[model samples]
Target: MKKIKYVALLAIVFTILFVTKANAQTWNIGFPDTTKVKAILTGNKLVIEGKGAMKNYPRHKIWKDSVTSVYIKKGVTNIGHHAFYDCRELKTITIPDGVTSIGESAFKNCENLAAVIIPNSVTVIKRNAFERCTSLKAVSIPDNILEIEEYAFYECFSLENVLLGNGLNQIGDCAFRACHNLSSITIPKSTSTIGEIAFRECYNMQNFEVEKGNIKYSSVDGVLFNKKQDTLVAYPNGKEGKYKIPESAVVIGNSAFASSKINAVRIPKTIKTIEGDAFRYCHNLSKLKVPNSVEEIGILPFANCDSLERIKLGSGITEIGMYILSQNENLLKIKIAHKNLKFSSKKGILYNKSRDTLVMYPRGKKGSFMIPENVICIKKGAFEDCQGLTEIVIPENVTTIEAIAFQYDRNLKTVTNRSTTPQKISSEVFSYVNLKNISLFVPSDVVDKYRNTDVWKEFGQIKAIE
Candidate 1:
């Protein structure tokens, strides 16, 4: 009995040794011919050591799930691209002082990584370097860093504080997008270039503070603007109520007021240009008046404003972009000045000054609509999401209908086409409309032509317009 017990104990000891050996393994992830750098993993700790730049591992070479900590030795000069990507269990990282750069997506999707020490020796934080580090709470940009590339900290929901270094010269597009908890950001004086939508969708951001003597940028009332204060750069998403554009301002930057909570905005006559998505997603904005000084307006500048009810355009406008007034659930009218040479309005509907092309129809307009006698083309998304439209009359001169011209008009029950020959159009033009349940009316001589047409033939009833 004593001998058997001793044998069982020995068996247990050997099993423990085997499990330990299996859990503690090593991998040489360095390029011996080019650099002396090496990555060695033992148990849950990963150690990066030696000199020169480390090899870029787009995918994890070590057991990423098992690594809870990382210690980079002082001699390493760079952290290669995607070196520790998707290390879900990695909780801490200690970057040494000699590392000069953090490569693209080096630590992307490290969900459990709560803290990282980026040394001052680093100059560039490449695109997506620390993207989606959901648990990270704070970051301090080192003084030597020159640029923070696009999507570097995107969707880091728990990040609340950021300290920008004075040496930062540029911030790439969408660099901090969707960082919901970020409350405030200060732009350093050396930053000269800020890409479009760099701070978009930061819902809780309240203030944009610019350090004194920043020659390229400035801030007033927590709003960002160029140094001369002529161009509005960004509006904090957390602020509420009416805002009056300064008389000195001439241009509104791209996505300057996107996802903001302002109920109204007063534009001055000096403002000449409105960039794309300037006021998008401002659910509380109710009215807008474009002054005569404005010469150009970019695409979707005022799209998706749920409370927008009226827009007045002045005569000086010469250029307008597509879908500027799309998806406003409560918009009721677009009133353009009669002297305007490029566009016109009839019964609140927007059209080219010649009145030959229908540009936009308010989604809030209800009941049936009669196409004007001179209209020749229907623009794309002209009648999209107009849920109250029950019938439409197409004039004889109408020759073309663009894609999604009548999309999402779920309540439309009838369509009357006055042409003798069916106008060719794709089925996508009527997306979400129940073609089989609605009736199509055509001129008496074209009943057969309408029934034989590709997209028109799907109608439930084809009848002569007696």
Candidate 2:
């Protein structure tokens, strides 16, 4: 009976001691003070943990200068703002599965971080999470991650590759700014919106390979490789000079050859569309031969070509761009395959040989000018600024004369036509300066044809002077 009594007494004392300790147990999260928690440096790394249940890892104010790698244990779900910010040497981090959200500036300016693996349970990664991590090379996002917030990977210089998550839908603005080493990148098909400046200044970015017909802009073999049927653009690496693209290529991208030195070019028969600045500022390009397959021409495609002297436009082309041959003063000839076609200019006129448009004279030649026998029409401004012209003759088969065919001309005194058919003449044929003293001399049988038409309206009466 005495032994039983002693055992019961000991049991009661132990139970009292256990209850007292449990009542005093208060939560202490990692913080500056021990009462709350302690973020102490154990050697090289900083360790943070919770002291009690309710005070589970308080959000912010962590990572002193000595911190290297942070470990968010099983209970950490919410990491406060700027928690591990600007820790330059923090190379690696492993967040336990229970951790969910990472706050803004959480891993900002961690320059030595090479790579990161986003956990599968993380739904959202807040703003500037990995901003300016210059040493980071690549990152792979988990399949469950839905959104990556603003500037997450902004200015990550060494980030060369990124594995997008399946669930990821969008990339925030300026997400990958100034990533110089990123030579190639592949964006996932599930992504819908890529924010502005997301891939800006990625100068070395050469190609983007995606699902068929998905990417709007891409590159192939150091050439602009777009799958959208936009255009096959080629850019010269060292200098531009005499490019011979196959006739089968189409479309030229904007600024593909901006500010280059190409002296001459031979465009093939396969080209269909020429975009803006297709050949701008090609300072030395003296001549261009456009094939018959082209239809439409864009502005400044050949602007400011100082040495350009001749261009042979294709037969099927309809609309001509403004200033297509601006500032090409040395140009004295243009050859086209169509006779009934029209061309405008400030000076030179279109000379027709059979169905082909022939030479354009800037300053009309003096002495004798012979029109090809099978010529059809003479277009506007063809001889506008030709002040030196004195004598001209129409060959046996000449027919049409457009507006200002001989405009802004002086010292022209005589014209002789051998054409059997009457020429369709406009009143402004010689209206600019001096057709008053000029006389119309026609074939004997064609006297009535010249008299009836406006060709000799401002000239002296036509005498059968053939």
Candidate 3:
């Protein structure tokens, strides 16, 4: 059976490679007149020698699977897109100084394409240039290049190190998605925009050093200092169990520790901010202590940490990011030192623990809910997907009904709001429930105010108190 399985798998792989080759119709490398090169596959390397003809390498037509490592003749200048894409056996490529442009997806999805040396002469790198080369351990950006287009080197899961070229300015979105093995990166001074999710879902990347801070950007240790730079990040820089961040460190970039294996962390007092997801999804993480200087905790800062139950947020923290502590099944108690907390639930708000208004519930709780009136706003999605919640009530002083604030509750039904003549209503206040449209009681005098507004009309028939 094993032999048969292996044979079948090999057949499928060959079939796919053949299709990729079949679809690869006469792709040109340098353009103009160039002899067609034949694919010479020997052992693991695919040798294309320009047939020792044309006085140069073929500018057009390459067999994508015919070669594991491409050797360009001395005169080649441009390497076409997807020319060597998905060459699993490809390990290394040496692009001589002669090549100038490396087209998009040129070496993309080449899982085994490990080492590459881009010479100084190259200038433009098109989109999806080096995406998903899982085994691509490391590569250095050429200082001469001006831009690295979108989706460059994305999903290089095994990628661990990158040497940024001096002239680099922009890093496109999802550029380093799920680079599980990537440990650290340095952002040079010339870099400007670290695009959205530029490092999204990088599981193993722990620390970064930004030499020069961006005009409006910042960095922590080395992680992209998220908007609020107060939070600092430190992972197992080496395979150690204990670690501490220096006081000089400011912000802990988002997702900096999303998937780190650290058991504990101590955030110093110098940190004034903690970006969202700074320590998110730290599965093995068990304890955290935020110093008193931290005034804000960004949204979902500690979400999805299944093993985490204990965290210390000092007195200086004023605002708590929305769902910051959500889904922490082990979290049963949250001790807040700030008495005058101003927790705002406005517009699906991120809770401001610094305000000292709303009381964070213990991880495990039973039944009815009542949000104090002093709490000025109720954040959107604050209690989303809370499997334990059943019945709840809101105080009258509350004003906004944050979008999707109370959606996706399977058993939660019937919420009574006490806001006598509070503010306007928003959409999706009560949805995804099997029960009847739960009533929201508002003073009859102000029902007109909410009813007239376009935001509250379609959600589910609202009723006013007489």
Candidate 4:
């Protein structure tokens, strides 16, 4: 009988300890004046009763992992920055109607958060507010919101339905980038600014619909454009096959065709400018012909085009950006119109009009190559990723080799430099090349010069030309 009584006493003491620990988990969420607001964690629920905005919490808040649901009372006015960041287990949140803003990264990386009620009182959704919320399937932005900041919904893989409020005025850069399931979006009339790459990499997106009476933008056949339709703002990534640029379009906006499914594009003579990354990552694009009306080409316009075999540049192109044709694994040739006074092409290699500066070496070109006798300098990344190059001979006239000029030429085995005096170059000029096994041949008279140079000295074998 005494043993039974002792066991009962032990059970009572354990129960009391458990209750104390549970009560200790409750947190005061407001400022020093705790009387105004309080937050309690009971079981899987987070109950927040407040009269003002909650304080921002660091990424590793104690309750982030345990809370599966949140209920904010109507008196709360705002959701502070990073308030629930990385709350991977949070599945639902009831936002009160009086809240005016959702702070930056307020719910970022909450991968399991599937449902959230954004009340009509919110005026702004700060940057990265719901980024990486993979389980969120739909969102309806209320009519009172004014802006959605940069990267607000980036990489939200499951988001399929988005209803933008008529009062929204701006969509910041990359706000909805990489939202793969987002199939279509309608821009309300009140939206005046849609930032760059906002819808890039949305592989299933087929159209961008703009409401009528929009003063700043318009849409034609599901293509987004400026009010006058002279600038092609964006091309639906899901649109396939050949597309002809309208004669009225004078410019191709930045990233307009990035990661699109289009295989071919016809450029009309009216196009005068091709902005940066205009045709980047169009894996199916095989060939292109730039018309004579185009005068400028922005940075990396044709980079990473896996199937791009040839490109013909028109005579009017006076400005060309760096690495414009880099990383194109299948690009075999670059043709420049004879009338072009600034650039030229010879044997498929790009060069300055005077043939003095080697601009870019076709990454697809195979076998050995001899630099032209007139070439004096090789531009940065001129021969980057030329995987098939087994040998290269630099002429006597070459004086400079820029950074990364021959990087990643893993197959390169021999390099013969004809200049008696070694050209000064950075160590990055031949990055990733097998310097320990490749042979370097230099003029018999100055083999010692290459043997002492910084980058050249690293080559495995230094031999004098016979």
Best by lDDT: 4
In candidate 3, what are the lDDT values of residues 352-385, reduced to their tens digit? 6443234345344456676766666655665665
Per-residue accuracy of model 1 over 1-466 as CA lDDT, tens digit each:
9999999999999999888767666555555435387676778898888878877786765567788899999988899889889998889999999999998998899999888878999999999998999999999999999999999998898999999999999999999988889989999989999888888889899999999988999999999999999999999987898899999899999999999888889899999999999999998899999998888889999999999999998888886654788788788899899999989999889899999999889888888999999999998888988888999999999999999999999999999999887999999889999999899999988899999999999999999998
The Cα local distance difference test for each model comes to: 0.90, 0.62, 0.63, 0.91
lDDT digits (tens) for residues 335-433 of candidate 2: 565632554222234443333443355342355576655556665555554566777887765566766767766777777877767676777767675
Model 3 lDDT-worst window of ten? 51-60
Ranking of all predicted structures according to TM-score, beginning with the best and ending with the worst: 4, 1, 3, 2
lDDT of 4 by residue, 325-435 (tens): 878988899999999999999988889899899998888889899998899999988999999899999999999999999999999999999998899998899998879
Q: Give the number of the best model, judged by TM-score.
A: 4
TM-score computed on alpha carbons, candidate 1: 0.91
Q: State each candidate's clash count.
A: 0, 4, 40, 0
Q: What's the TM for model 4?
A: 0.94
Per-model TM values vs. the true structure: 0.91, 0.42, 0.62, 0.94
Query: Candidate 2 vs. truth: CA RMSD?
Result: 18.5
Rate residue 148 of model 3 by lDDT: 77
Where does candidate 1 stray beyond 4 Å? 1-22, 31-35, 59-62, 426-428, 431-434
| Winner by TM-score between candidate 3 and candidate 1 | 1
Worst 10 contiguous positions by lDDT, candidate 4: 24-33
Off-target runs (Cα >4 Å) in candidate 4 are 1-21, 31-35
